[model samples]
Target: MSINHDPKALQNPMHVRVAAAFRIVELSDFEARVLSKGYVSREDYDEAYLLYAEKMTAAGFRVEHLLNSQGYYVPNFSSAARDALVAKGDPAEEVAKFESEQWTTIQNCELGTFRLVNAIFHEQSQPSGQFDS
Candidate 1:
């Protein structure tokens, strides 16, 4: 597949679609679509993500490339907590290592549950009656 070297082409819907497809869909589905259409490939996804990271960084956003649980390179938006941890003498690598060591499957499951419950409570507490039709 020929690579588009133009940076403006990164704004093309095809690039966004390809990147979103790879990120959100199952691997098998993405691969099947690529094989059937020949419009985009895994390389396209990587290029699109790279372009996005570059653009975001140029705009002064700190984009940290972190490995997801599936071992894929995912871009994480910078957080103040991460910055504070780094400022306190713990290197980013050390913080990542500590996070990996402490973030177990059970902890992730509990966090998911906590987030869901929090969302439900937040929704319930909203003034829905004010917007009643």
Candidate 2:
């Protein structure tokens, strides 16, 4: 499938792309699918998610933050449409459903989800003892 690049995808930094898909989906598959639709491969999505922890620090956003927030279902930060569901009453079940569907949708588009994802999770850092520097 030839990926059709969307203008908004440019607004999405490369690192966020990688972070959004990390563990949730294989990065290779994500890249391949997006490219087939004319989307660009953005490594910055990873940097935005992992390297720029400082910018999102004050907001309580971080890679490890959502790992424990029951998978960040409260806000549905994965996509704009999900935010609507997040705002609805009793959206817990809907949020989970959206996540499953997002994994499939994002395979085709670079969503602006990193900022929202980071917003919910607390910033994580290397373990106190793991710093080799």
Candidate 3:
């Protein structure tokens, strides 16, 4: 399925809100918001995570959630780290190894929206005269 990628085209307000939040916040902060008290239900968290995974994947990123010892779900946004896991050959074995290392929980989220947000943030962070015309 083709993802719209356009924020304005999103029908769910929560999806739009989550996408907007990701634009200005770091991955940990974003996860914090979702895990905040009374922010959303368990089902809602799953939905929001699905959207996050979709957007990250669209931006050429892999989504891996790590359940830290502090009981917080942290997202691994490092491409090099993900690449290292991929280099392990078998998908099942790689996941097993990764989970055994530090994370108590490891989930692969590869559903489809946030390429536009990533692009906007990337462009804004570029120095003057550094952007390709």
lDDT string for model 3 (48-102, tens) is: 5567666655555666866567433456664545466767665877766765642
Ranking by TM-score: 3, 1, 2
Clashes of each: 0, 17, 4
- Local accuracy of candidate 2 as per-residue lDDT tens digits, 16-81: 443443432333333334333432323433433443333333333222333333432222223446
What digit string (tens of lDDT, one per residue) describes model 1 on residues 1-133?
5444322244334433433433422223223333234344335445445554565555444667676674344556554554577789997789997556434422333221222222222233443342132
Instruction: Output candidate 1 Cα RMSD.
Output: 16.1
Error of 2 at 40 (Å): 12
**lDDT comparing candidate 1 with the true structure:** 0.41
Ranking by lDDT: 3, 1, 2
Give the Cα lDDT of each candidate.
0.41, 0.38, 0.45
- Off by more than 4 A, model 3: 1-39, 80-133
Query: TM-scores of the models, in the given order?
Result: 0.30, 0.25, 0.31
| Best candidate according to lDDT | 3
Off by over 4 Å in 1: 1-39, 79-133
